[model samples]
Target: MLHTLPHAEADFRALVRKVTMPKPTTTRRLTTEAGAPIADNQNSATAGVGGPLLLQDQHLLEKLARFNRERIPERVVHARGSGAYGYFEVTDDVTGFTRADFLSAVGRRTDLFIRFSTVADNLGGPDAARDPRGFAVKFYTEEGNYDLVGNNTPVFFIKDPLKFPDFIHSQKRDPFTGKQEPDNVWDFWAHSPEATHQITWLMGDRGIPASYRHMNGYGSHTYQWTNAAGEAFFVKYHFKTNQGIRCLDAAQGAELSGKDPNSHQTDLLQSIERGVYPSWTLYVQIMPAAEAADYRFNPFDLTKVWPHADHPLQRVGRLVLDRNPDNVFAEVEQSAFSPNNFVPGIGPSPDKMLQGRLFAYADAHRYRLGVNHTQLPVNAPKATVADNYGRDGLMASNAYDRHAKNYEPNSYSGPAQSDQPLSAPLALTGHTGTHAAPAHAKDDDFFQAGELYRLMSEDEKNRLVANIAGGLAQVSRDDVVEKNLAHFHAADPEYGKRVEAAVHELRED
Candidate 1:
């Protein structure tokens, strides 16, 4: 038996007291950038308390300098946005179509960040604006980060990327008026016959989504997927909202825009906070590579969608957004996504819009957020290390392997590239020249637009006609309005007639 020491209880009580004591107030002191304690944040050093600020005060100078540069440039497009953290889980076996490790097996889950944005809007623009919603997702997988940059619509305004800047400029505020001019918008549409399909969709009932959760997302561009066997297929992605499609009518959207500008962002945040997670079921329409040549439409056209009947959507996976970002600025605003960020098995198609985006997006991010943007927590790969020769840049926080060589092709064992290519090489036999897309049997600008208009219900047709008329009536130029009306008429005689009548009535009013 051990004998208790004299004053043992006293010593034990002292130890407990030390363990339970509150931390020192000094530990909570405010600090400067270099981590030195700041003596006073409320007061600045001055010449004599009543004089001009002292330049010798390092903290005062640093604070104002940092505050001056607190903001980075916003995105040129898709500026107004919200984001969330989630996971994409493969619910079916899709290994035959693509050897992408993220979708390698059933029940495989990949962490992801999704940003929902409104195209052609400023940061301060209303969320309820009738615009194409951007649905870009960045998946952090073991292979690396994969970004699927897309829009809500299955089609777009123009087929060629060369027209993108002009299309956007027309949609943007006019230089003279500082407002979106109907003449500018309508003139562009009248000239771009390919835009008729997307314009019809845009001015229709679903122009404004009720909330971010209720809208469907589409990988509008066709992509190429190569399997483990090296066989390739063209694919398009669709994310059907489990919450179901819901849209705000023109009146409702207008009211919401005035009353609550942050309605969409707030709705998403609160829904996730209350444990009501939003989910989307992922589907892919796959076409064998050889069939693209003889397809009814130019399969790579960004302004046309493949008819679902020809290639039915196959169930692939589910994406559930379960977490709200703790810090929106750090996680959402600074987040960078690029379509060029492809893992193994997946590659860009011959779609001109997609080919342009492969360069434009990454270049934009590098310009907006420094070259080290990928090293940011939200964008950095979670399951794998980025072992490349990329070196020092702004905000490069990763620990450098100083001993290892920075350049490749070295005996010192620098990071080397994989010997295998990401995807199979495309067959090329054409002379390099400016050319239009190869014509397919049923390829025409107005056919699909007509098909879409004809598929709408009678009520939807009424709304579409009225919406188109409202904007067209504002255009000062009669030629622009008539040219646009002619394209709608080409789609369908009834569609053209209805829009013309509606525009006349609106003009009279």
Candidate 2:
């Protein structure tokens, strides 16, 4: 209710009392969250002599297996998240730029699932921590599923996807110590100064959002949108919050992290429950397809944003998340969304990270949730599905075809390829180079971070320096501290000086 609330009121409370529900009761009796009936929640159905001799007991095996696989591989990144359901309503005529059905017409309401997450953290980590918030959305439109995976920040740390795994590892806990290593993060940042931009955002006031509802969302990477007329336009999505931008200082964030580890989750859930639906005006910056090649910066680079002056956000729609999931495990936990799951009208750019994710996200889900993950209601397409030939796998529900040919090229007029139900022909001209790791460019990384640092308010800039130094200062080596500060200085002198001061304080201690 809090996700869509007008305000706190007694009438809303009374309505909530009327609808607030109890734990669900299904046809099947009490089972595990994975849906295996619990014959023994009180005690494990052990052997007769309690000697662990019976190998024939299947229930015990089931119990062990269920317990063993309880975790579905916490996301390699964006491990911590809260999700909800709602609708996207087209409010503008964007059909000229992209034929994406969700934006085809006004009053068109498409079901949507949104997952808001902290970029760096385990599933159980503090919600109010100083980190980037992930804003990924999955829209079930008439064509198919469309997943817009993004972050709260408009730009990223690096331009190339080659450094993504390394960047993630630097932020994650050190393998040897099982603790976040300042040395690892600083070393990575010092070497790749492109880290400065994202680092600045991470250490500033916006790092710790007051709540997920109060922050904005960005597509982060530039994308391409095409209309039915076979015309293409470069696009970047921005979800400006109606509630307005709100954030926490370091002390306040620390206090709230301890007091409420699930603060953001609770706030979003509460806001929806109260009918104060949190909304974002969805806007997109559109660029002509012909202009991408001539643009000053590589349009496909992940670490940069097209300046609003050059490609102003043209309002396309409004994204409103108003409903909470009925079952967390079924609806939220099992949900699998990917950037590759695009409908026809919308598509990806040559953005390397986006290209890599096209394969990686679905592959990860296959490992995590088995190949039939999409069969789950949460991830399944509400639009017409022609998956008749998609054969059986684990948890196979409808028998696809008993008589028809599962293999393709049958004379029975089996589901043949449509003229173009799949994708628009995106042109590629550059010489295909070695696929190992793409070449890096002069403007590939650093300048954007420097620009971002220069844009922060005075107080925000100070906090950025202090927050980064407070963590980096503990590195024990002055060389390590100084080395990282040099990268900050390369970003902006003021940025470096303040961080230097904070580091000195720790050195004194």
lDDT of each: 0.92, 0.80
lDDT of 2: 0.80
**Model 1 lowest lDDT segment of ten:** 1-10
Model 2, 66-138: lDDT tens digits are 8897777777788788999999999888877777767788989999999998977898998998888999999
The RMSD of every model to the true structure, in order and in angstroms, is 8.9, 11.4
Can you give the lDDT of residue 35 in candidate 2?
A: 76
lDDT of 1 by residue, 1-509 (tens): 11275655765685577568775676577789999987666677765425688888899999999999988999989999999999999999999999999999999999999999999878989999899999999999999999999999999999888888899999988989998889999999999999999999999988999999999999999999999999999999999999999998888999999999999999999999999999999999999999999999999999899999999999999999999999988999999999999999999889999999999999899999999999999999998998888888888765987687777788987778788777767767789988898899999999999999999999999889888998999989889989999999999999999999999888888
